[model samples]
Target: MLTKDGCKQLRDFTEKNYKETISEVAEGVWFVLGAGHSNAVFVETDFGIILIDTLDTLERGEKLLGIIRQNTGKEVKTIIYTHGHPDHRGGAGAFLESRPEIIAFEPKCAELEKADLLQDIQKLRGTRQFGYSLTDEEAVSQGIGVREGITHGERRAFVSPTTVYRQDTVTREIDGIQVEMVRLPGEAEDQIMIWFPQKEVLCCGDNYYGCFPNLYAIRGGQYRDIAQWIDSLDKIMSYPASCLLSGHTAAVLGHEEIKRTLGNFRNAFEYILIHALEGMNAGKSAEQLASELSLPPEYAELPYLVEHYGCVEWTIRAIYTAYLGWFDGNPTNLHPLSPGIHSKKMTALAGGAQNVWKTARKAMEEKEYQWCLELCDLLLSNDETACGEALLLKARALERIAEYETSANGRHYYLEYARELREKNKKG
Candidate 1:
């Protein structure tokens, strides 16, 4: 959730840059660009049209189907999934009129069911990251740079695949289109890349997208294999792809352009992984690694490498945690006191809640928002009566910080915290 001003800034940015439209990437291939924070690609074949991932919800899926009908009017003979992400597969049932043959890499029905068990917590965190729970006035866009479509009732649109490829790589001749799908696990466990030998078109799922990919979602999940992800990118780079269509954003045209883009994308992640590991091997803390690691000017300057969704520091932390567990080699944290207990002691040492609150207000006035938040935390630790003023100060501080953030995820997290504070105040 964003404050009014913050939301306005986001909306303005989105209006200028995030508008989606349909386009023909190749002779017979059409892209339903940015339909629902994701894109669906339809490939015309001799047998019929081969539909790629189905966007987000049923409504968006239906809208895409309408576009397909208007353009090719070819009945869907085959449906292929790039991954198991909701945005990519949630709208599967929307185009059931043709009863297309569905395909995906090694069916994850059981795994998906297990993942669904944690949906309660996942959805909560997802709402914060996506501003899904934001009020209309306070809501804006997501990391994909589009306003997420609201879904109603049950997600009855997602349909399971009829055909599952158990091998690492499989080739099929679907409707005269020589389709090659390789299991390149990276962004998601069930991720795959589809290559059209005849057309030389490569359909990369969320693995290769416009913005810096989410190596580690703030909404917690199993560790994404960074090394495996890098290897997967290398595999895609091997292809002589004239046209590159991704899960989100528009298609990248020309072979040279696709190569350059994918090369830089791979290097960006490799750069982060190398430097972070180097710092880690040197016994540096995650905080220190995050602060010290910096992308070279060449890699940092790319439009697609913008930290709009994934932050390098967050990736560093994820790498650290994945390899070394939660213990950051800090003895003080080995058996730490509860945050509330520690905060209570600290507030007493700072004189009293009144003195701390005064300092917090002064910090806010000086635009030292980080300091203000720290001071407010101390005050609210011991005194429940101080919560209202402290929360207000914290919310304001967070909102101000969110305004300057380039990463939408960073902005959303800050704004979400502010929303939490405001809601708490309202309850009181």
Candidate 2:
């Protein structure tokens, strides 16, 4: 968790460097930041312009495109999608006035089409993860990247791809500039990297960002392929690019700086992978390995590598889960009862729900938030009368944690649950 000072420092730095606005990344390439929610890159060429990723809504896209017109006065002739994420490709239709050629990986397009099957659940989880339900002050402190508050009505402006490629490397020459669409599946199964060979500028989608890469999203999903993610980093590192741009955060300039940044990013994952594998081999439990794994002091010192997005402990568990199943080889866990069953029994042993609540309130007063939450959970599980008071305690505990959370997502998760609890209390 970040200290209050740490969060304020990061928030200020981001607002100054990469916050909601349009900025030039290279000679002909511009990075359009949708208030740190997502980024779209546009490359100017003789024919017109090649756009990479559109902002979330048609309104935001048109607004950004207007800025691009005033700056470069170029019409968009082509569009490239880094992945199927809505924030990256949602405003695609806003450029239809130029009849631009839209490009995306074949599988990514398919995923978007099938995403509707999980629409309701995904949207609900997304709302919480993004803190869309929170007030301005609460939401701003929740996470990094574009912060969404106002809703855009009739927002569907996504354009179907006119060109879909399946190869690992798809080459194209838009007007006069040579562009290579390199498939590097990390973050998402069909994620791609746009490499402008002539300019020696790389647009690294979500694969590379200013913060520690999210190896596993807390909102929930299948385990990310850490090996593939590491390999993707290696592939991008091999490029002798002078500029590195991403779908989130600010651009990385200069050849040596880009090289060093990519090298360190790759090394961080390698260290986690190697140590976790070693721990597993030595018969360490997943929990034990997660608690023990830590990045080197040098890696830890890099502000860019801070747990702003993903934490080392979560990465350790994810790697362990990927290599081994959920069994964890613990006999008790293999046949454990439901969570509520354990909570109910634990509450009884602690001298009934009232005793647990009294103890929890005392812990809360002492700033022992974790212990308060655990004790509150025990009481809430067994006694309906304690729901209102228990939820309040949980909310307090969560908010306290949020105040010092270093990971943006981690802070969001804490505050989001607290908000949920407060809402539940209002209902009753």
Candidate 3:
């Protein structure tokens, strides 16, 4: 029933992201089977099962549904969404029609409701930079992920929450099982967690997945509240959890293990968020600030806080925006010249396009990526095709720097841009 392109795309995606092992944590509790970007956890009772997270795609969901059926014949009684991200909720359509009631953290509902307001915050910042003349394939090929990465953040018109809860704390008994949710205001304004008190089970959701928490998604939105994220970590630490699960990645078990990992996570978020604010408050320029700052030694030592999603530096910027708007408090920037206007003026002042290109390459050679990228943007904006030479150069420069990237999102951005340059050359 699928078209050739659809089939190929599905096959490619699946091969890229299929899980081999699904863990059975305990009786009536199973880690929802998945690998990469999404996870689902199911809790079973005499009546039925409560599922958390719904895979990432409808196609992916269909595959997960088939897998879930292979595991158990019982019907799902409810679905709990930890947050409103498409990766977490997009695949819910398959689960809903199958007869499960949907439950979501109340703040996630707010996130989903203003959902229209939530556009892929990253992509908005990116495409608005040039235009969507860039296709998904084009974006992917160019290594231009992040704000202009692949998918639309647009919510799929599918199953939404049937019930919601509000407040910093909420608890419930599900068929004699006690679950507690503590509101964490970091990642999203209304985000919280679903904790199984009786079981010492903590489903941190997107909050502390193995990957570096997406402290700042390139697809723009409100700068993620890192301070709130740290506080959320502290709250989770208070729980005597025997097992800790995330929206993606494997389940981490044992009180000592969970405590150690969660402790590092709290420290990392606190370190990144606090340092970013402190640097900005001290009047450090963006580039100067990034150079001077580093993650706390303790956080950098932990494997749990690895940069799978959010980069340490970008997270700092996110904190910067959270504390102060984008202006950088510079009066000169209050009425700065526009990109096109400024680039032209800078070009004229520098003598010519070639002069600017030469200077940028020099900065790049010295490994001053920040300055190099800044100049490259100016040249390219003046005339993209004219700056085609610089575009290819920028890509090469980004590729090397990306090797040092800690977060997948940051690497995606650098690599995508590099790929784009290569593709453009082939066409030219």
Compose the digit string of candidate 3's lDDT tens values, residues 1-428. 11224223323333333344576786667786443246778777667677777776665556656666667666677788887776677777777666776776565323334656555654645543322444444322111112211254433334878877766677888767777877776666656778887677888876776546667767666556666677788888788888888776578899898888888778777766666767787897665666677776677646556444556666666666667767787799899988888888889889888788889889889977767878878887785325467777788777666555444445456666677677887787
What lDDT does the true structure give each of the candidates? Answer: 0.79, 0.78, 0.65
Pairs with steric clashes in candidate 1? none
Mind giving the per-residue lDDT tens digits that candidate 2 earns over 350-372? Answer: 88777887888899898787788
RMSD of each: 3.1, 2.6, 7.3
Model 3 residue runs over 4 Å out of place are: 1-19, 33-36, 108-157, 348-351, 359-372, 383-388, 391-404, 415-428
Residue clash pairs of candidate 2: 1-405, 1-406, 2-404, 2-405, 2-406, 20-35, 36-145, 36-146, 37-145, 37-146
Mark the regions of model 1 whose C-alpha exceeds 4 Å error after superposition: 1-13, 107-118, 135-137, 151-156, 383-386
Q: Looking at candidate 1, what is the lDDT of residue 293?
A: 86
| Local error of candidate 1 at residue 355 (angstroms) | 2.4
Candidate 1's C-alpha lDDT?
Answer: 0.79
What's the TM-score of each model vs. the native? 0.91, 0.92, 0.78
| Better structure of 1 and 3 per lDDT | 1
Clashes of each: 0, 10, 18
